[model samples]
Target: MEKMTLPDWMKEAPTAVCPASSGKERKGFLDRSLRNFASVLKRAFASGKTKDGPMQNLEPRAKLAGFFLLILAAALFESWIFILALLVMTVCLSAMTKAGAAPLLVRALPAIVFTAVMAAPAVFSFVTPGAPLAGVGGLTITAEGVSTALFFVLRVSAIAALAALLVLTTAEADFFRGLGRLLPGFFSAALFFTFKYCLILVKTAEGAALARKSRTIDSRGVKEAQRWFASRAAFILKKSLNTAEEVSMAMVSRGFEGRVATAPAGPLGFAEYLWLGASSFFFFLSFGF
Candidate 1:
């Protein structure tokens, strides 16, 4: 049998030269990417059996209700002081949860930064008319604009921190169960499955990237790399569809009927009642003050 050989034109083609990256550089890039991905996964799925975390012992429904109440307060208030107070409460509660402030802040940093960036434009007099605080040519920073931006940032930060704290302390299943109680049956199931699949997709992408990095020995041109990535993305999309179908079939086989049913919530304790009352009072107070 004759062995396969390159065509005459391909055999005669000139080898293209590509800029070479050091193995160390490639390894460093891969490590940083993987570490970031891992951190996101860790933060998203954080749930521990802490002995005395602030949110650890609360019923899921109670925690969910409290979170929404505080979030509503945060949203409705325009006062920077109130927003700061909420931020402090969130930080203090998170500390009591024993989930390490550093990790929580790190995980929430992206959202915080994004919110700040999005709100930064509002600080200019052009976007928000008010008394000028400072100016460079026609671009003036107004006092009212500054206050609005600060309030926006603080409100967003508080809400994000509260959400992170809740998710970190509460088990994912319990959180979903609590959410299921509030939402319609089909919507609850969809939300749960959507979030579940999103994580799976992230994991799948990470694995694919690592595999590609392991096999890659030489640096390629930007065009080649882009093409490869596009192909890989298409492959992942196809794979995800197949996986989703399989999951749906498996769930149906196990008696899933587009509804997520969780165990009935138990009676609220004294502590839960107190927490609810305090949250309600604060929420209402935000309106008056």
Candidate 2:
């Protein structure tokens, strides 16, 4: 093989400055947030796939009915103590379940925090005027407001905890199937598919974020970052529309009509009866409290 010499221009070209090494690079805020979100979703998806748990063997219909009744009680009950008790029981049940309490808490924490934040204004005299409990920054904090805010937060927490517990213990298919038995098939099917679609969307968004983060070298300015986020949001919106269309067409091709057919529900067993009784007992007991 003959050796070739470099051109004169190439030889005269200034040596390229070595790109400064950003040693021990830390993950950006957005990247960390994405990772946390993906992990939460993973935990949520994995929740009901377990083969062993306290509630795993119980029928989904039974669980659904019992949870529904308890949630209703939590909502209607006037006593904060009762709601708090319900929340405590839910936490204990979650501990007994294979999915554990940590993941369930993680799933519910955002909603609980949001509820607290939204209800925070209710503690001010302007929102719920009454005898003043304390004064802060020239604003009166009313006793009535405090009670109302406490009640509201507790109710929401109890209800949310119960819902999260149900999701944590039940398989997606079984849960939806049971739901179809309780609610109209059309509605259950809508909810089931919508939930699945949401998961898909989150996964897609996470992947997109990772790809963008991998390609990003220099930090972008605030305006640039905002523009990029807006563009990504629009892209996700468009993709969601296209996906929904494709899904609908595929369903129609597969013989899906407006109504979804569900399997016939079987007779309730001892466990089912027991669950119903316990739920009823708690609900009725609230009357006394």
Which one is best on lDDT? Answer: 2
What's the lDDT for candidate 1?
0.77
| Candidate 2 per-residue C-alpha lDDT over 36-101 given as tens digits, one digit per residue, 9 for 90 to 100 | 877877776765576478676678888898999999889878888889999999999888876678
Question: What would the per-residue lDDT of candidate 1 be over residues 179-250, giving only the tens digit for each residue?
Answer: 877766678778877877877777777787767666666666677667867887898899889998999899
Count residue pairs with overlapping backbones in model 1. Answer: 0
Q: Which residue segments of model 1 deviate by more than 4 Å?
A: 1-23, 27-35, 46-51, 257-259
- Give the distance in Å from residue 14's predicted Cα in candidate 1 to where it truly belongs: 26
Quality of model 2 by C-alpha lDDT = 0.82
- Residue runs of model 2 more than 4 Å from their true location after superposition: 1-33, 117-126, 129-133, 137-140, 220-227, 230-234, 241-253, 285-289
* TM-score, candidate number 1: 0.78
